[model samples]
Target: MNWSGWSIDRVLILFVSLAYLVIGIQVTMFHYRQNFTHKAMWIPVISSPIFLIAGLILTWYNAPWVHTMFMAFMWFGALAGLIGFYFHFRGVGIRVGGWAMRNFLIGPPVALPLMFSALSVLGLIAIYWKVR
Candidate 1:
């Protein structure tokens, strides 16, 4: 239950928080126009699976069933967010030559991450309590 003297629960907390932090950064970047295109959106979408896989591997190492289940829920929530972004981008792509397409791209980059981060935070807290 310990890794380098840290409890598995603590590691889970750290990893989950780090994931949220990354998501927050992504949201902020999009909100500020640092990354404002369909191509840039893929950065987080591609990185998410890496986070999920790392979390799951750690969970398996620790054999925390509740934590694992919580992670599964978090993964599902993330997937939903990705799907929302996809649709949002799809909408923009359909109107690529139109004047308002730029405005449409802005919504998903910020909104989807915000929604997903809230859900993931709740899920992480639940898992942390369960494991503790």
Candidate 2:
């Protein structure tokens, strides 16, 4: 673990952190437009940045506690995304012409949450994987 204490994992984690920032802003804006009708809507808005900060912190500080906490949060985020997918999917089903293409397109995006989960998974991989 030389090269100024950076490796492929660190770089991937950094990328994921920045990505969280971008997705966080987008979710914030989207949720804000809805006035955050449900309390759960606040989950991603708050946790996303935490993920980003934790990840970014990891890029600089290679501490055991940091790694431990980051691992926990990534799992949390991954689960949140799955839960969100259910919510979003249900939301679409609630709309007119339920399960139709238009509802799928016009209702809450179902993919975003899954994407969120995927990103968390990627970070988890970067955290644990051995690049050889």
Candidate 3:
């Protein structure tokens, strides 16, 4: 209701946030359903979707606080991704490759979380600009 001066910037940032949420959900669900063996690591996989959902909810209402909320979610997601990557590379031994090489057995690992981190950082910058 308080959408005072909605502009392209706001619209774009909001769109990016929405895209982030959707992509995150898709990745999380696909990973969960595919890998039933890694029960312990599922927490990080599962928590991301919830964060994205919260980000979507807060962003939808055009709330001023959305920036801070998103900051929290994105940062958490980023941290989780970093930790996941470390463990995967160090201990999990999951194969990594380009998108073209991806198959049923090996999904994109490093890229997804890295993408999340990069996009979230972009989202944060966009939020800052919007607030400024």
Candidate 4:
């Protein structure tokens, strides 16, 4: 289906991109609060489902680059969630160690959103590029 030269695949990509963007915003806001310290949170409540749905959409559409990007984004989100869990349990004497752990703990809030934004820009470019 085409909507004024926009194909359904492009539309789906746009939707997935927007979903990630919104999720990124929510997670970043939560991080800014510095308040995930006490809750037994295993995942980012907002981003997990949003990204899950976006992943499903990308898979269904079979868009190669977008789907790969979504998988990478999900991996990052999961790693970030794991770091949060480790931090939460650390207060009770639990410990975790890995070289990447430090990066995960410090980077997700900024990196995740930028990834989503980049995906959005790519989708927009795809939507507008001349279909030869």
lDDT of each: 0.57, 0.92, 0.60, 0.54
Q: Model 1, 94-117: lDDT tens per residue?
A: 664643746565434436654664
Between prediction 1 and prediction 4, the one with superior lDDT is 1
Using all chains and alpha carbons, the TM-scores for the candidates as numbered come to: 0.36, 0.94, 0.61, 0.36
Query: Can you write out model 3's per-residue Cα lDDT over 1-132, one digit (the tens) per residue?
Result: 567766655565676567666766766675666674556367555665666565566556667676577667767766766765664444324444422344323643555656666666666665666443
The regions of model 4 sitting more than 4 angstroms off are 1-43, 94-132
Q: What range of 10 consecutive residues in model 1 has the weakest lDDT sum?
A: 105-114
RMSD of 4: 11.5
Considering summed lDDT, which 10 consecutive residues are worst modelled in model 2? 1-10
lDDT of 4 at 63: 74
Better of 1 and 3 by TM-score: 3
Pairs of colliding residues, candidate 1: none
How well does model 3 score by local distance difference test? 0.60
> Which model scores highest in TM-score?
2
Compared with the true structure, model 3 gives a TM-score of 0.61
Q: What TM-score does model 2 achieve against the real structure?
A: 0.94
